[model samples]
Target: MEMERLDRRGLWMAVGAFVLWGVMPLYWHLLKAVPSLQIIAHRIVWSTLLVAGWLFWKYGRGWLRETLAHPRAAWMLALSGGLIAFNWGLYIWAVNAGHVVETSLGYFINPLLNVVLGVVVLKERLNRVQWTSVAIATGGVLWLTANYGSFPWIALSLAASFGAYGLIRKLVGVPPVRGLGVESLYLVLPALALLLWGETHGEGGFVAHGGVAAWGWIAGALLVFGGVLTALPLIGFADAVKRIPYSMVGVLQYIAPTLQLLCGVLVLGEAFDRDRAIGFGFIWLALALYAGDGLLRGRTAASAAAVDT
Candidate 1:
């Protein structure tokens, strides 16, 4: 009973996290007037403060000290931090610049990219079905590119950067919250410098010549709340990952991009013509094939183990 309850909680947490992520474009749109880079800077600054405080409160100074003392871990986290920062900046810019649909496409393609990265970098092997799905997804992307008259660089960049970040985190074996806290710390100095430069050049958004009220105070409040928005989903995801099977988590991942696609097409009134529909259709079919193969393989493996036992 207890285990079942925990699993249920985990499912809800994971779903909530993905839902929040899916809706994030709406939040970023509210700060559309702010430069994406500046917004990312503030995100780094505020998230660092909040995460650092949480780390201190939860584990005392030992966790931070130990993490800093491990030179290799620190270096790996720094690299991952840079990748995530780049991803965040690009995603924010894309969402506010009317590339929300493209961004969704990138995330939809991310799991396949992760599988490719695993095969190439980690020497993992894929079955025939997995390879077929990857091929289909590739075709989908190619179709989109050919029809759109150019490469989908925005989507590709987002997928690659995030995939790389996930790879590094997996290799490093760092606890998610502490790792995020360290990553935030790694980013703080550069972010602060950028924010300072923006303010000096009259480009900052939270404040102006008059006061906080000039930005309606609501915007200022939202900018500050960006830290909470950044951290909360991560916390939920960490909790979910700990309590649920990774395959289930993988299945749940689609919720985010699906919601993002809906937001772009329905809420934001983005252009979604027949060409896009065809491209996305192919990708969706590819994902369905990929997921079905995974579940079938998992069941087979479990059955074999059961028979052996």
Candidate 2:
């Protein structure tokens, strides 16, 4: 009973963290004064600082030694970092451009991408229902493309990038915080170079216009918030994974994107055309099938385990 209660707590924590992440566009809206690229640079720079400090505090010199000891892992993590950076930059640009609706659509489509990645990259087999879900989702995307008369490139790109990032992270097999810390370190060099160039070329350097108080502090604050939010959800996810079955956690993963979708349609006032609605409907049906398949498979697996025990 106590264990079950703890699982519930962890689950709720995961949900709350995701909810906070989902509503992030509202916060980004306030930072519209800054250019998107500049904001992204700040995000990388500040998150790097925060993650570096936390790693040093937690692991002392051992963290550095371990990272150095595994060059392959380090390189993999660095590549993963780049992918996430691109994802963040694009997401920031999309939000600032008032495409939150499409952004939400991207995340909604992401889980399906995850399933595809699992099948292709991990050599995992999807059950019939899961396969059907993927097919349905593909149809939805096609419908949307036809409706728009051109591909919804932004949405597709966001989903692809983020899904690829997640796959890379899974393949790397490092602890989430540790992996992210190393990736942030990897990003630091290019970010510094960009900041330098921006300082010389544009008025967008963190604090180039004024010493350090101009808008650097605000950027720094956003970076800190982003890092905290990023880290918290990751920790919550890890915790939930330890406590609950993957089947449950997998289903709950949709909560964040669903909330984002609601916020996009209701709060951001993004329109959903007829074709887009049809597309979303197909996607929703696909998710339902995928989830139903998982539940059934989980039950069968549990029963087999019981019989064996």
Candidate 3:
């Protein structure tokens, strides 16, 4: 009963986290007047501050020292940090530039991309179902490209960058919050430099111009709030992973992109015609196959272990 309760709690937590992520396009939309690059810079700066402070409060600085002492981890984190930064900047730009639907497409395909990365980079073998799913997804992408008269580079770039980030984090094996903290720290210098350049050039959002009252203060507050937005969902996700079976979590992950798709079509009024619908149909079929295969394999493996024991 206790375990069941815990699982239920975790499910809710995961749902909340994914829902927050799904609706985040709305938050970024509010900051549309701010340049995407500047928003990313502020995100890095403020998230570093928030996470670092939490670490200090929890562990009293020992974690930071230990993390910094490992040269290999630092290098790996640096690369991951760059990838995440690129992903964030692109996502913010995409959301505000009316590419929310394309952004949704990116996340919808992200899990399959993770499977491909695992095979290529981690030397993992895929079963026949997984292989077929990948092939179908590839065909879907091809169909979208051909129909659209060009590549869906925005979606592809978001998926590839995030997949690479996940691959690196899997190999390195760091705690989620701490890993993100370290990545944020690694990015701080560049982010600070960009903010400084923007301010000096009279283009920074956090400063007032033309006698606008309290503009700088409001912008600064919103920028710091970005850190809270970044960290809260991460905390929920980390908690969820501890209490739920990963297969369930995998299925739940789709909630985010589904919400994003709804936001794009219903809320933001983005175009969604027959061509895109056909392309998405193929991708959805592939995901259903992939997830069904995983569940079957998991149950089979558990049953085999039970018999052996």
Tell me how far the alpha carbon of residue 113 in candidate 1 is from the true structure, in angstroms, after superposition.
1.5
Q: Is candidate 1 or candidate 2 better by lDDT?
A: 1
TM-score of decoy 1: 0.83
Q: What is the C-alpha RMSD of each candidate to the true structure, in Å?
A: 3.8, 4.4, 4.2
> What is the TM-score of each predicted model, taking all chains together?
0.83, 0.80, 0.81
Tens-digit lDDT track of model 1 for 165-281: 766765665677888899999999999999899778767766663333356667667888998898788767767756765435544666788789899999999988898888878
Q: Please give me the total number of clashing residue pairs in predicted model 3.
A: 0
Model 1: CA > 4 A from native: 1-17, 209-215, 235-253, 296-309
User: By descending lDDT, how would the candidates be arranged?
Assistant: 1, 3, 2
lDDT of each: 0.80, 0.70, 0.78
Pull out the clashing pairs in model 2.
none
Best by TM-score: 1
- Which residues of candidate 3, in runs, are more than 4 Å off? 1-18, 209-220, 233-254, 296-309
- What tens digits encode model 3's per-residue C-alpha lDDT throughout 1-309? 477578779889889988998999988887776778888999888888898888989988788778767657788888988998999899999999999988887876676666666666666677788788778877876776678656789988987887677666666656667777888889999999999987777657677644323455877677779978877776676666556654345446667877888899999999888988888788778778877887798679778878999
